[model samples]
Target: MSKQLVVYISATGTTRRVAQNLAKAIDADLAEIVPAPPFTAQDIDWTDPTSRASRQHADRAMRPPISASPSVDGYDEIFVGYPLWWDTAPREVRTWLESHDFTGKTITTFATSSSSTRGALGEQLHDSAPDAHWVNGRRFAANASEAELKAWADSIA
Candidate 1:
């Protein structure tokens, strides 16, 4: 069996729950992309343009520091999950991606969004880990079932 890893960041547990289901569905190891100092409820308030998340989204070059980066070594496939932020992965995700060398690994991105589509999420992340083989990403509803996740994983893997 191929070693798989599910890495994600969830500001309010929505993405976390999805990542858990995905990891379980595929029998993959799980890891969280926790931001340094963590995120407070107020930090992610999208309505507030000055909120941390908002500021970071506006700054294309901003890469928030992560608390820790999980080792990508030995993993044959890595699934990166995050809540869609401005139709793209969070800057924190970028930090984590940039921290690793996914030279020949297979990377699949998944996201959760109440409204927005996945957009060009997988392509947008290419520069951060330029050498990895990227698969097209999918956006799942928060209540997506284990079977649904497993089917998607099977199709990709």
Candidate 2:
């Protein structure tokens, strides 16, 4: 079996937990895609749609900086985790995806969201990395079971 890597960008900690669960199941390396400066509570103002962060997201140009870049070489399978924002991925995820090369590798995505469907996020990932063999995306509640996530990861492998 080829080595696997789980890369995640989390906002509310839900995605981070999911990523860790999946990584443990597959014995994969876990890499957190932390934004350079990090987002403050004020920057996430989900309550105020007129906030700067919200406005930048509305314009589809909210590219938050990343603190570290993950190495994709030697990993045949990559599992990416994130929270669904604005019916898609967070801007930092875009930065991470664009920063790496996944040629000839299998890419899987999982997301956690309160309202949005996983299909939308999966489609967005497919669009972003057209050459990648994107698999079905999964959605779980904030308090999902570790066994459930492990089973899902095993099925994909």
Candidate 3:
């Protein structure tokens, strides 16, 4: 079996739950992309235009440092997951990808959104990671089932 890793950042556990299910179904290692200082409830207020998330989203240069990374040397396939914020993965995802060298790996992103579409996020991240071989990504609902996640993993793997 190919060694795989499921890496994700969960703002409020939506992406975390999906990542956990996908990892179990595919027998892959699990890792979370965490913010250095952590995010508070107020910091994640997307509704407020003045919130931390809002400000950071508006600025394309905000690549906050990631505090955690699992042993990725053994994994050939990487599954990147996050909830869609402003139709894109958070900048922390870019921070993590840039920090690691995914030169010879296959990367596929699985994202969730309540109202917005994935909106070319996989392609948008191409600039951040030029060497990675990116596959087409899939979008899921915030409450997607384990079977739904497993099916996508199986098809992609």
Candidate 4:
């Protein structure tokens, strides 16, 4: 069996739950992309256009901190998970992708969002990691059931 690693970053824990479910279903290793300091609830305020969160995203794009570093050479398949932000992935995810070498690895992306579809984000991921075997992307509800997540994982497997 090919070794798999599910690496994810979640703010409110929604994406984290989905990652956990997928990891369990695939019997893969679980790794978290933790920010160095972590984001407070206030740091995620999307409602305020002028807030630090919005301004940083607007100007610098994704600026999340990465606490753990990944060496993708060992994993045959990597499942990268995050929440869709501003119709794209969080900047931290981009940073994570840039930080590693995924030369010949298969990458599968999954996201959780309240409104945005997965199309735009998937395209962006493909653009970011052109060398990676970018599989399709899946969008799950904020509170998706474990069975639903497991079924999705099985289908992908």
Candidate 5:
């Protein structure tokens, strides 16, 4: 059985790359946090205020619907990853977390960012899965290497 699970949401494939590398490094299961309708390029355009991504970021209470929640029954460690949007995770991640029961699991977060750090993600996402144990999360560059990802995973473990 896989002890670790790596789940991520990547609108433009950046975070998906990181999550895939991390899962391979740790020999974990992988899952994608897919949006119900799936995002188009125009919907994720950061420069457009009317974009779906922009509207979700502007409203803190928003929880964008996910197509399906991943099952977390046997994993001891769960890694949640996403692209850093407005210094936090996309709201769809929150919806994914809220959909699962992670009372005894260790929840760790990671993000892909161009320049911003993954700021206070555990604190920001606490209410969604308040019962799980959360560890400090890291932000990585788009081209972060396999060695770097393994090292980070070792340190966190």
Candidate 6:
């Protein structure tokens, strides 16, 4: 079994595509952190302050319930993927992180975003799993290539 795992949450499917490619490239196991009551198209609307995403992003304490835990046992390294939502990962990531044991593991974060910056991810992720070794993360364009993903995974390995 591969020691590495590629786990991610994608509300709009873009991050899911990237996660699939990254897992294939690195020959790692893959898992998705799904949100319970699942997100409707309207729930992701950033423009509406009343939207589910907007409400969650506006508040720090909202840890959205995930469907289940993607057990992290036996993995030495994990690459966490997500879309850069409101300058950080969606709150469901917090739900996923809290469910796992990351001690002695290395976590490298990567995200897909329309913005030029990777946004405020490192601190949030580190804060979620303080015992895990966190590394510098990268932001990828929506059109990021498979080769580029492979290269990044190889470098981390």
Off by over 4 Å in 3: none
Worst 10-residue lDDT window, candidate 4? 118-127
**What is the lDDT ranking, best to worst?**
1, 5, 6, 3, 4, 2
Question: TM-score for every candidate vs. truth?
Answer: 0.96, 0.87, 0.92, 0.86, 0.94, 0.92
Error of 2 at 19 (Å): 1.1
Q: Residues 1-157, candidate 1, lDDT per residue (tens digit)?
A: 7799999998889999999999999899999999997988988788999988799888989988998798999998999998887888879999999999999899999998889885435788988999999998899999989999999989876
The model with the greatest TM-score is 1
Which structure is stronger by lDDT: 3 or 4? 3
Model 2: which residue pairs collide?
A: none
List model 2 lDDT by residue over 53-151, tens digit each: 576468675566789768788988888888776667777777787777777888888888887774433667665557677887778777777788788
Displacement of residue 70 (Cα, Å) in model 2 is 1.4
Look at candidate 1 and tell me the lDDT of residue 139: 93
State the C-alpha lDDT per candidate.
0.89, 0.77, 0.81, 0.78, 0.87, 0.82
lDDT by residue (22-61, candidate 5, tens digit) is: 9998889999989988988987788999988799888989
Q: Which pairs clash (backbone N, Cα, C closer than 3 Å) in model 5?
A: none
lDDT of 6 at 134: 89
How would you encode candidate 6's per-residue C-alpha lDDT over 1-157 as one tens digit per residue? Answer: 3499988888788888888888888888999988897778898788999987799888988888988669889999898988877778888988888778899988888888777364534567778888898887788776677789999877766
Worst 10 residues of 3 by lDDT: 118-127
lDDT of 4 by residue, 1-157 (tens): 7899988988889899888888887788888887767867876788988753576668754555688866676898898988876666677787788878788888888888888875423667675667888878788887777678678767776
Ranking by TM-score: 1, 5, 6, 3, 2, 4
